[model samples]
Target chain A: QQQVKQSPQSLIVQKGGISIINCAYENTAFDYFPWYQQFPGKGPALLIAIRPDVSEKKEGRFTISFNKSAKQFSLHIMDSQPGDSATYFCAAESGGSNYKLTFGKGTLLTVNP
Target chain B: EAEVAQSPRYKITEKSQAVAFWCDPISGHATLYWYRQILGQGPELLVQFQDESVVDDSQLPKDRFSAERLKGVDSTLKIQPAELGDSAMYLCASSQELGQPQHFGDGTRLSIL
Candidate 1:
């Protein structure tokens, strides 16, 4: 079973617009939620992360809004740029399993300049 | 900045051939992981190691896939008699310790004919 589920397999946004991607997880044991960005021919890079204790975390133009009670989290990119076109994956990890991550399928975002 | 290193950025092998990929984690990092990603999907963990010992490998196809981290620094993943279905991107990641964010390498893309 897929432990994490992501919505909008693909997305398109104009430059300067806000691009959002959402993810939901089933396991309540998950405490750490992170987002990764991957470009073609490269590995996924850590974008932003949040712990269950925080309702939101922001890093530069990237922000992660987490709702622990709803078992959901979303990533928001302010002023999306063409360079932001890539695949994004949301992941969760629990303390009990040595912090092994379970990932969402992915969301391919395209930012039109 | 410290980063994970991987060799042979891309490889193409015929079905039934043997293949191997190498990874070198950041210095002093004790946790290592190997993940497989199919097209349009998120990466899935195949094996995880804490130093030279494997902590999890339940998703690995033991009959044909094997991994080793002898010195607790670098790792090698091998597949014998590969199948067409084995074509995917093999990614290696490392972390300082449990619960820490993981850093990923560019990954080795494998194509099985």
Candidate 2:
């Protein structure tokens, strides 16, 4: 109930290929889902977020797919590039909370040219 | 680019030593947070402050950790008699209002010897 399990502890994708990271959360109280990107030695920053009301949200080359019934969400990266190589984290937050973000262990993504 | 600011990008201390970190949130942000991220894991929330009062500190160690935001603009996190297991990245984030997206700082990488 407290953990958001993410898959593929590490991922390797060829340039221009698609990179997908999945996360499954057990808490149905989580109303907001967000993905964060963190570079080496840097803090994780919000990349994109979506509410449960929306099935999907697209921001530039990144997209978030939410499944209410499945209690799962994913982050999709298109045209993977070396610059995009970084650790991606999937997070969840319950409504009415001021600033609490429960995050997954994280997925290390490497895009090879 | 008004971003959350953190001090002493890195710190190396020995066991039983004391360590401190500072954070200046973005202007007009009323909510602030402190998070600890161990290597190979996602960030974990240690505390949350609303303006000058602490709204939550459920996960805070309490034994050796304490935080405060006197003016609600700048905050500090302190640890006394630090242990080796305490070595990790300390992150600070702030949001404009409740339930809003938070902006994070680069974070302080602490290595306890």
Candidate 3:
């Protein structure tokens, strides 16, 4: 059913610019939202996450903005760098469901030098 | 830093051949998960385990795929009579417990000829 939907399958941003990726979910029961970054030939790494109880959460250069009522969330990377270029995925989990993650399609981000 | 470990970073096998992948979650983690990621897509959960006991395997293809965490620490995933469509990256992740942040391994890239 594609419970999670992500936009802009790919993106390009100049160095020092802000990179944004958006995602939406269909399941209202989802309470946990997390973002992951993956390099080619590697598994994903946890980036930042936010719960429905908060509107936003930031860790260093990464930020996650979540809207509980709209069932949508977004990831923002400030001062993006070439090293930050990678595939980003958004995932959701409901505590009631044993915390099994449902992931988005993913967005390929390219940061220009 | 503790990290999940996976073996056989890459594997190439012909169709109908049997293949297996292994994972070792971070020490002290109590929850483990296996995921399959196709090219350009986010990972999908194949199975989840809590202390050597399966908590979820509904998405697993039981007819050909199997996974086990016999010691509540290391785990193995097997695919018998692999098909070309089975080509994908197998990732293993672990968390301290259900509803906690997950840490992933580098993953095993499987290519079925």
The prediction achieving the highest DockQ against the true structure is 3
**Cα error, candidate 3, residue B105 (Å):** 0.2
Segments in model 3 whose C-alpha atoms lie over 4 Å from true places: none
As a TM-score, model 2 comes out at: 0.98
Task: Name the docking class for model 3.
Answer: high
Can you rank all candidates by DockQ, best first? 3, 1, 2
Give the chain A TM-score for each candidate: 0.98, 0.95, 0.98
- Mark the regions of model 2 whose C-alpha exceeds 4 Å error after superposition: A96-99
Residue range B26-110, candidate 2, lDDT tens digits: 9999999999999999999999988999988999999999999998889999999899999999999999976899889999999
Ranking by lDDT: 1, 3, 2
- lDDT (0-100) at residue B38 of candidate 2? 94
In order, the B-chain TM-scores come to 0.98, 0.98, 0.99
Candidate 2 lDDT over A1-113, as tens digits, reads: 45799988999999999999999998888888989999998888899999999999999999999999999999999999999999999999986555478999999999998
How far residue B82's Cα lies from its native spot in candidate 3, in Å, is 0.5
TM-score of predicted structure 3, chain A? 0.98
lDDT, model 3, position A24: 99
Model 2 interface Cα RMSD in Å: 1.3
- Pairs of residues clashing in candidate 1: none
